[model samples]
Target chain A: MSIKTSILSSIGQKLLLATSGLIMFLLFLIPHMGGNVLFLFGPDMFNSYAHHLHQLVPIVIGIELLMLTSISVHMIMAFRVVLANRKAADKRHTLKSSKERSLAARLMPVSGIMIFIFIVKHLLDFKFYEKAKTTLHGVETYDVYAMVLSRFQGDPVHLVFYVLFMVAVGFHLSHALQSSIQTYGIYVPREGSKIKLISAVVGWGMAATFAIIPIFAFIK
Target chain B: MSKQINLTLKVWRQNRGEEGKFETYEAKNIDTDASFLEMLDVVNDELTLKGIEPIAFEHDCREGICGCCGSTVNGKTHGSHERTTLCQLHMRHFEDGQNVVIEPFRATAFPVIKDLIVDRSGLDEIIAEGGYVSVKTGNAPEASTTPIKKEMAEAAMDAAECIGCGACVAACPNGSAMLFTSAKVSQYALLPQGHPERAQRVKNMVAKMDELGFGNCSNEYECAVSCPKGIDVKNIARLNREFIKANLGKN
Candidate 1:
């Protein structure tokens, strides 16, 4: 890309990643999460469901690829925007001082990187390799579903990590989702307040949905 | 929770020029439900009927939509209430026999024009720099033609709600116009209508804001708190992002 195209495309890419990520989380991730917490329905039911999903190899692979690409684009654009913001701010201050960004806003880039890594690990452990599960009865069974459940029920460290990650995701989404929509310039005058409310609600849904998985496992 | 109140109003009084003084006036039997501007209106009416220069202040749209009514009332921009304009602030916030101090909105860019009216024309100039859609007529398309998502549309509108009030500058310790300018920049930059001149717009607006001598936004949240429109500081974050993208090159 030329300097001009890259600059414009960078903004375009950021908008795409942000808006897509928001929809993915709100419409897909939250509902998926509701179905993922299988302790209430027992391991057998959840395992069969997982097996059935695994049977759709091509479709699942396609989705995973699309998700990976989308997520990578989101992270790359996020870091670029954050760096550029800092640079612009520094120039304005001319080495005299710095602009004050909130702790939550400032932490977005760093927290985003962590969340990116955690997401990869999450997909691998639960959906891809079943790495969380090891040899079982000399059969090399990787009960992907059970591995996720075991983390909350048996592994305190994993449970804690899960909860912490969810909280970070909540904070990130609160700023990111609202900001991304703004960056893209899509709201109407009459609907502005409703969108703000929607942003908050989506943030809460992400936090609460992700939170439920760990809490249910830990308690039951 | 209502009560009759007596207030000692130390309002700024000046005939002309930079020289001015806080003249005390007793406003008795003040209704607690009355807005701060309304109370001032009552006082001004009394002054007007008495053949005096009715306290020489500025106000418009006492409904709080217009950003015209602004002053430093008791050390707070737009009065003590958070995210409120002077018109929205009611007397019930204060007690009877309380001393209320009212002064002009002080800032380098906002020079005092009269008793309470400050020259906010700087903001207008900054807006004129690139705060508009440059798309030519005859080829202009409908807004609905763009398939913008509901989420992005809302954010842009929120930023656009900023009524050109300099409260953000007044609230800033550095006297930064980032919040105000950013809101203007973001509203356009976020939309496709602003795409043609996006890079130049941000760069030019920032340059103008700086040329106008407004301070930097240090994220004090005071601007957000004091903003009658409640423009969030997140727009500043987006502004920083837009500035960076703009500086890289024009697309």
Candidate 2:
């Protein structure tokens, strides 16, 4: 089959989902997590990082556009795959699911929807919200660090919600990372595989790191 | 003497092209040693004696290898036993007074033919899409000359063990044939005989699978769990690799 038709096929759709998901995981999520780490270093480091990031407008715009495309593709592919699966599994036995199926794997779609909500709320609060003006490293830029603090500070409900959603992120990524590797046809051992362990670590690790900001802000 | 257990079985009943429903039957004095199919046989006999048509499930070769007997029992494909087919599933595994929900493997591609039998011809159609080495090797090459790596052969053999049972489809949330197709692809991809048609095989089989209205695998690994042969998801990874290699070769 040609590339055009191939991409529309069932296996092709999975390949698309895996590719788009990996794009987000690598280009956006990883860097996003790394930048989030700066918040823990106090306002100076965090504000300076944001200020420098704002200076790279062209690169940032380019990444944002790319991320837009990736997220769109990822969402579309997931939607299509889920619909097709629902159709294929038209009738289900009342009794379902082998115990061997992981809860993380089963909750993928649920976690996915939760993450999407988290992203929107996150972007609205941080990306779109106006930050107080600040001079950082001799440049006037948004006080992104302060903005993050204000959002999470003294709001127990907000802190709890943030942490809860991080658990959702953990669930989604734990399965997604390894599943994507397998979809790419890498030989990850089936039983007791180190790749599975690493995937879970990276998944929960990022979630924990991201959650730390809200938690620390709430306490401080 | 083997102990006996009674089970309350809620078996799905339907006519061809008709909507199915659960019809419960009481199976008393079932010997624990009796296979699941034999338990059904006893149930069928009672139904026949009552002047009612028996549960119209399918079975052959009472052994697990025929891939003939399969049903979703308690929501698990092939009765939820790891690496066990329905025919090999014994009554001993069931608890007395337990309620068993038995139904056909449900998938859009796998239409219910009767009570517990589904038309699994879709699997055969997928196999037809190039699950073979069409290019005949003129003669059997010397085993020494072949130099097949033991690991590769073992993997190939593992894949080839797939009996084309529809259990994987039944277990999958998406009803995807990925595991089955991957196994077929891997069986050929790993063997030298399959080298000649390697690229074409993957491309064609994948194309057919898509064309047949099967769902894409979301990497749930449910299929591997339901497979009586214990087929691993690694074959699917191999299939993906083969697909990429095949497409790249064409380009």
Candidate 3:
């Protein structure tokens, strides 16, 4: 009856999660993907892109807050749904077998938690870290691109971590995309296969594109 | 008529609202062509002759149309066969000297009445919330009165195939009835007759489902897989959409 109670219902919570997740993907992930492409174009272009982003301080801060809010909402709803689902089935099955569910679907919560950790670490290392000294003509410049390059190229551990996180992203997105579509009730029976295929393609594409940047940074 | 087989059945036995356990029973010389329920009948006959308590289960049509008879066989709701109810599952699917595990549908809402018989009246209560269209009592309208699209009618029929068996809840690890709820919602949501009450129908049904202790669908899709009617998980999505539309007053 009330708006809050209506949204807090099991299905309502899921819808909220799906809707927020899609918005996060569009607002944060797509732009992040586009920006990561700059890594391939050498340090100058990448640094300039980073600088341009910094130039729009107010807008950037607003977008960052919005992204944070989206992630927080998505995560809270997910946790509630998980708790409700657990409570609903208090008795665990002795023999567990799920043949129809996709691996990505099964691994959603696990991958989600991992992705949360990765996002926090990523922000701390790249966004929050400030003192990167690059000396050009005996003058030190706070170099964003140089910082990224050093983090990826200098540390094999960081590279591996980045790649692993991308894989987790792939797992989450593969299920999330089609799930979001379904949650929004956009399914046509005839296009079911196509929807699944597209979700897979987009998920893997985003992951691969993001993952390739760290690999290219190390190798090149 | 196939060769007869003997099966060691591990059937769940419990009294009303009490702790239950698996009670082993030997079903000997069972006809391979006989239905799974028929095999159970043979076992029950042996138990009765031995002055032991017979296994209690539910059945009506024995033709798969009635949703009454449902048991988890070897951790599979409605037996191991896809889209097949327990009454329709033949004994030929099993091997000689096999160990078959039969249990009642487990869910908070569907408490076991006794043995394999569970009180699935929770499903009926969910239906009663809003599973129908209101119509005045009168002569039936002409068949061609409302022109529905071929695809829409087919999709609606696909959803309407749900027999209201608690297989979806039983098969689900989370015991979610989203599949059943979605199927019922979609059946009417797809038809024009169901239009007037579409918003209210989904809202009430979903509310009752959650209120009755059915789990939220985590997209595990086990419900869809174990459903006797082969109901699509897409219906769950449609239910989500309908719920959103209803809440937003768009419907």
Off by over 4 Å in 2: B137-145
In order, what lDDT does every prediction score? 0.70, 0.88, 0.87
Q: Number of the top candidate by TM-score?
A: 2
**Selected candidate, larger lDDT, 1 vs 2:** 2
- Who is ahead in lDDT, 1 or 3? 3
Q: After superposition, how far is residue B214 of candidate 1 from its true place, in Å?
A: 0.9
Q: What is the clash count for each candidate, in the order shown?
A: 9, 2, 0
Stronger candidate by TM-score (1 vs 3): 3
- In model 2, the Cα lDDT at residue B149 comes to 92
What is the per-residue lDDT of model 2 for residues B81-195, given as tens digits with 9 covering 90 to 100? 8999999999889899999999888889998888888899988998888987777568876769878899999999999999988888888888899999999999988989899
- Give me the TM-scores for chain A across all models, comma-separated: 0.75, 0.95, 0.91
Collision pairs in model 2: A95-B75, A96-B75
Worst 10 contiguous positions by lDDT, candidate 1 chain A: A89-98
Candidate 3 chain A, poorest ten consecutive residues by summed lDDT: A133-142
Residues B1-251 of candidate 3: C-alpha lDDT, one tens digit per residue: 68999999999999997989998999999999999999999999999999999999999999999899998888888888899999999999999999999888888778889989989898999899999989777998999999999999999999999999989998787789999999999999999999999988998998899889888887767888788889988898889889989999998
lDDT tens digits by residue: candidate 1, A68-157: 677766676666555444432221110111133334555676677778777877766565653443443353434655676665677788
Question: Fnat per model, in the order given?
Answer: 0.01, 0.80, 0.57
Candidate 1 residues lying further than 4 Å off, grouped into runs, are A1-220, B1-3, B49-51, B138-143
lDDT score for residue B186 of model 2: 93
Comparison by TM-score, 2 against 3, better one: 2
